[model samples]
Target chain A: MKLLVVRHAIAADPVEGQRDSARPLTSAGKRKFEGVVRGLKRLDVKLDLLLHSPLLRAVETADLMNALVEGETRVTSLLARAPSKALIEALDEPSVALVGHEPYVSELVAWLVTGERQLARGFPFKKGGVAWLEGEPVPGQMTLASMLTPAQLRAIGRKK
Target chain B: MRPAHRELEPASDAVEVDCSAVRIALQEHVARARDAEDSRAVHGLRVACARLDVFLRLGRRRALRDDLRWLRRSASNLRDLDVLLESSAAGELDAQTVSSLSTERTAARAAFLEVLASERCEALLDALANVPSVSAQRARAPLERLAERVRRRGEQLLDAPAEFERHHALRRALRRLRYAREWLGMDCTAIRALQDSLGALNDALVRETWISRVERPASSALASATSDSSSLVQSLSAGALHAWRATRREILELPA
Candidate 1:
């Protein structure tokens, strides 16, 4: 199975009396991620399934990617925060895409690549960054095939 | 050792890590490294150097390896200095040692800049920019070949006991195999674990060598550092060898 993990695009910083999970993607985030989706299309990215955290920004990001690629978007609680084995268990498709938040997104990438959660330290993902891994969901089984920052994706879109 | 995916790629348009893309990222990292005005920059530069080294070797682009080697050599001291200073700032190192290392680090930083500013370094960057698109064969042929190479190298490490160079050779071989597997997005945990352990052991050895190169500020401290580091290296090395043997045996036991 091939897994494409992405961090939700830019969102408004939390303020007093705001629920962190309620924050939505900024307008700029939407536009930039749209361009990124276009670029991924140029690269022939096709997702059989798209999954996202229950948070607003992540759900929106997943919906956007699903609009560009042929996939069914499903909101799951497993991707809300730090990833657990339950996150992998939720995957049933041959090719999958995940949209979530920082630290969690990068953490998942590191886990997929190294299989040790502790090694996930320092693998930070920029807002809207994406990583691709090839392997089963099994621990220590996945390989990181590619990783692209949001800027790189935008540039690829421009080039194409 | 267990082939995670029996079929590598059936799609006619399967796009792997293209050489052009890799080159572009490599160039960006080199530029970022050059603009490295802080610790993060230095860390990024060091990582880029390591990745470029592995990519160059795996692709069999021997021509560009020397340039990368020079870059890595020049940056090594700077990286260590950054780590030590970071630790010092966090109150991990004593004031005297921090003072001593800070002075040496400044000089090392200057030396690294001199190396980076050389015409040869610019030429190397230019060469990397023009690295031809990695061939499909270059990307795919290693899948099967890497498994065999890992098995062979692991066995060799087991056969040649107590030789520093032999252990180093095994480390390099495991790294090459891991890089290759990483490119293919295959399960590389077994090899990666071995490589990381070897890397830690190698780091301990490097620290010992660096201590010998510098004037001993405190003889007792120097002796203590070397003794602790050497023992750590020995234990790590033994553990790595044991792991490699187990990995090799697992691979051998798998039915074709």
Candidate 2:
């Protein structure tokens, strides 16, 4: 099983009239994240499941991701600040791609890889970054196959 | 405005496809890491380079080993500088020392870019796009070879002297072994923990060396600063030593 976790792309700053969850991905964010999907497609990553937090930006990111890979994209409240238990429960798939927020996404990666509740020091999950874990979906059963920054994805995507 | 997403076509079924992809990843990561100079990028570049090195070495392509070595060397001083600067920013080192280190980092960055542009590096990157006839049977050879090499290195580290240089070498060994285990998709938490301890020890030793080499002021403030820094380094080194010993023992006692 492979779990590909992605943080939501660059989002609009909090507006006076809008909630944080409603902030949409900025134009630049959409363009950069498209490159990420392109990179994944180039790698022949076939997602068996695609999930996203119910937040607008996460759903939008998942929708973009859905067009690149073969999978059903569905909104799930479980991915929004999901607890470790809920995160583990969501991992029951041959290959899953989860689009979510920062700190939480990085924390989830740490928990999945090291079985530690907190992220190992200095491990950052930048916006639009993606981490690939290969192993069983259970806690600590996975090994981080790869992690890529958005810049890296753009570079790879630009190659022939 | 957003551009249309690039359509992803199906990749070739060749086994080399995976290797080629990994190569692209290595190149992309190393290039991106060069500009960041952060701890995470430095670590990522090292791991990416290691993965490619293991894969290439397994394929008996020694030609690129020199290029990989150069890449690692280019990143080494910068990494250590970053570690030192992190603590220096907290007022451990004087402004003069911090400025000197930052200036050195700029030179290091330039040198790294020069190497990245070298013909050898360009050729290496170009060659990585092609993995000749990596069959299913041959695929397992690298993992087995890496595992054996890691085991041998572990034994060497256990018997090696406890000198600073030896421990540094051990740190490298642990990193290689851990990266190989990761390449093989094996659980590497224990090895990673040990590597972390070894890294901390290395950082402390680097700090001590830097302080000892750099000239300090002849004032009471300098005395107080030196005392504080020395104790911090001593404690850090000791804790790391203890962790290394404990982890090593656990490794040795594991089922063979």
Candidate 3:
């Protein structure tokens, strides 16, 4: 099974009195991430389902990925919290793309690979970056197949 | 605007908490419990809810904490009072003490009935009816930790048989271990004796508390309930202490 963990792309600066969850992906963030999605398509990456946080930014990111990759997109509160066993258990699909916020996305990847949710020591999953994982969705039990930066993913998308 | 009832499903790997057996049991019990005076129905409801709680906790799925907790609390007080009422009848209490308990039981039934008829209770039942997708994998981490926990509680009780708090704590922990094993379709006979002992001991403890709080006419059923409950407390405690040691030994002997 392939687990694709993604950090939400760049978002507009917060406006006064705006809930963090309500923040939207910036126009540039959407345009750039489209290339990343196309890169996923270029590699023939497909999803059984795309899961995203209920927040606006993650939702928008998920929508973009779903457009390119053509999978069912569903909002899951599991991605809204710290990476938990519940989130891992929910990844039953053969391929799932989870769009979530920063450290949480990184921590889920680390937890999957190392059984420990250590953030500072592992691959710094930059905005729109992704790590493809393989194995049972158990903590410290998965093999990291690849970790791709947004630029790398986009370049893969741009290849003739 | 968003859909009127938009809610995302649980994570992809996990199935929802609606086991068919449990759901049927809950719906059947809920129907019977609506009568307000049916103690058997209330008892059935509590047992069903407890089974669901064990499954959810052991499965480590964070789906229904608040609703389950509410349902448990709703069923328990009325359940406790009903037990005391039954004990009162069997103990041959005087007419006045029985009347007092009956009055209290009546009020409890009314309150419980009101809760059962609430929108929240309806939601819980609706939630329970959700069918689960089959997934074959046992979550071993929580079970391993719980096994360690039950063993620790057993040891604490073994070390000090007279500790009131330890008896209560072990009683609670043992129930979790038993139901959790049953949920996973694993054998639970290993801890049944300890569970029975703890069950009797806790019943005595609860009966004693109720007897103290209620009216006790001399030579009446309430007094007899008191004496019956009191006489068994020491023996039940001793029996549980032995069972604790036995169960703890059994747990330790299993391949860790």
Candidate 4:
């Protein structure tokens, strides 16, 4: 199974800055995310399942990716959190792209790949960075394949 | 040995104090054995192995890991032979059941029982007499490690930048936020409601994308079809145009 973990694009501040979940994507964030869609297409990555966090910004991000890819996208609360045994059991995809926020992505990566309690580090994915993992679905079997920032993506696109 | 409570520590440190790798290996072996046969004994063995694995992963801090280890191994051996016998009997019965002969079914049952006796199912039972009560403490370490990883990740998401292009960061943040709530063991009513609303909005966008890309083209094709048909077709096209204008008005009036 291959898991593509993506961070959502920049978003506007929520009304009165109520909570993180209430935030919306900024205009710049949208354009940059569209660029990400282009980058994924250029890479020729075929997604089987696209799962998003049930946050407005995350949902918007998933929508953009779903538009780019040829599959169904689901907004799952399971993808909204770090690794839960329940979430792991609930997953029924061979290849999945998750659109969510940080720390949890890093944490989930660490947990699934190492079976150890440690945080993932050294991948400074900006507002539109992607981290891809490829390996067995079993715990402690996956390995990181690539981490790309939006700037890196644009650079690659320009190079092509 | 009596169980002893200890302060929480890293898995590495705990392993050094009491090796859990051995127990994990044994549990794996038992599970593999169970998978090889389909029988009551195998089911029991699988359950026992699962329990041992859970015990080693979630048990209380003070429990004796070595005692738990010994009990698991003993149980594995007993369950292995019992599973083999039951599986042999069940397989024969399944074959007999498929055939339409009462005598063959009876003979199959008798042969299965004979094989069970020869397999020394009683000897396995005798060995089980000395099995000890394995505490559930052995299972705590893995669960603790998993929980810690989730909590740290949740904290990271909470502190991460909200705007990111790849959407992975935002997704991770949302997951961690939800995981944090789970870790805190709070009620899920508010979280569920928020999740539902977000899901609905996402579905709406997906539908909109599909309509714009696919349904609109089809609709336009349908509209053009009337240009070559009867006068009634022209009237139908006019009605369709009027309906489109009305639909646009309704959409414009909708709350943003």
For the second chain of model 1, what is the TM-score against the true structure's chain B?
A: 0.75
Q: Candidate 3 i-RMS (Å)?
A: 12.2
* Candidate 3 wrongly placed segments (more than 4 Å): A1-160, B1-18, B89-91, B131-138, B216-228, B252-256
| lDDT accuracy of residue A128 in candidate 4 | 72
- For candidate 1, give the lDDT of residue B123: 46
lDDT tens digits, residue span B32-82, model 1:
656665666666555555566556544554434545667767878888777
**lDDT (10s digit) by residue, model 3, range B6-33:** 1322222242223567667777888888
Provide TM-scores for the models: 0.51, 0.49, 0.56, 0.38
Best by DockQ: 3
Task: Go through the candidates in order and give each one's DockQ.
Answer: 0.01, 0.01, 0.02, 0.01
Q: Which of 1 and 4 is ahead in TM-score?
A: 1
Instruction: Please write out the lDDT profile of model 3 over residues A99-146, one tens digit for every residue.
Output: 887778888888889988875258578889889999989988989999
Question: Which CAPRI quality tier does the interface of model 1 achieve?
Answer: incorrect
Residues B1-256, model 2: lDDT tens digits: 0111112321222223135546666677667765655576665666666776665554544334445666777777777777777766575566776667788777777787776666445545643443332332344556556555545655665565445565676677666655544443445677777777777767767876765555555556556766876686667656656666667645433553
Can you rank all candidates by TM-score, best first?
3, 1, 2, 4
Worst 10 residues of 2 chain A by lDDT: A67-76
Show the lowest summed lDDT stretch of 10 residues, model 3 chain B.
B1-10
User: Could you give candidate 1's per-residue lDDT for residues A1-160 as a string of tens digits?
Assistant: 9888998988878879867776767899889998888778777789887776656677567656864546455555567668888788877888898888777887788777787777766577888888878988887788888888888888888883
